[model samples]
Target: MLTEAQAWQALDAVEDPEIPVVSVTELGIVREVVAEGDALRVVVTPTYSGCPATELIAESIVDALKAAGAGAVTVETRLSPAWSTDWIADDARAKLRAYGIVPPQSAAPGGGQVVRFMSRTLPCPRCGSTRTTRLSEFGSTACKALYRCEDCREPFEYFKPI
Candidate 1:
């Protein structure tokens, strides 16, 4: 009979399948977790709706909860509120940079307090220089955009904040 907090603590230990360096919680993926009757319901916000990672993430969330002794865990994806880069949280952003990916830079709200991930200039992950250019809006993954480091002369991807 684990409490809701206890269940979350367990789920928090589950790391992201793609970014193993950070857990889904740290990544702010788990938006809500609550116990209903004899079942546990978890809400996860997708980084990108079309991104294939959403499927795997949902599976991992369910498996992790069950492994943590959750009697019946129901992982649900909520798109109504949608996911935003702003929800990445400060801790997750740091973990991303340490994981060799250039995290999105926080900027003033573009229009309606919406953190603009793409409008802001992304620095090169290799050289840490702002003098970077976008080679393409699309990257190796649909969630990322291809970029070139002008200073390092290397190509890296910026995890666009969705």
Candidate 2:
């Protein structure tokens, strides 16, 4: 039988396919974990509906839980109450910064509204410079934007706020 704590522990090792440095749990994708007898069910909310790594993430979750002694595992996708970047763990933000990717800023202070059209400068993850310019709305991944720092002349990706 799999315990809820054990299921969660297994999931904590499941890293995001796109961002290897962070686990799905750290990204706030794993919303719930339920263990019933030897079966386990996990509720996940992707960063966006069209996220390319959604399938891969689901597979990873199932594999991890099964390896952790679950007899059966099911992953459920929840789209309602859509995922928010504000859900990201604080420690994950530091890990993103260390990995040279700018983590998304919180939108809670603004009533959970993010203005996508407005151009805003994000500090460089490498040099901590506000003199940065967005090179493209999309970066290596759809959830990230390409940016370059004027101070260090380093190109980095900024995780877009949902």
How much lDDT does each candidate structure score?
Answer: 0.76, 0.88
lDDT of 2: 0.88
Q: Residues 43-76, candidate 2: write the lDDT tens digits.
A: 9998877889999999999898888788888899
Decoy 1 TM-score against native: 0.84
RMSD of each: 3.2, 2.1
Which candidate number would show the highest TM-score if scored against the true structure? 2
TM-score to native of every candidate shown: 0.84, 0.91
Per-residue lDDT value at 87 in model 2: 92
Highest-scoring model, lDDT: 2
Q: Candidate 2 at 98: error in angstroms?
A: 0.4
Error of 1 at 85 (Å): 0.7
lDDT for position 105 in model 2: 67
lDDT of 1 by residue, 1-162 (tens): 457898789877888777788788877779989899778999888877677778888888888778777788889888767666777768877888877677766532354554345455777766678887788778877666778877888888777655
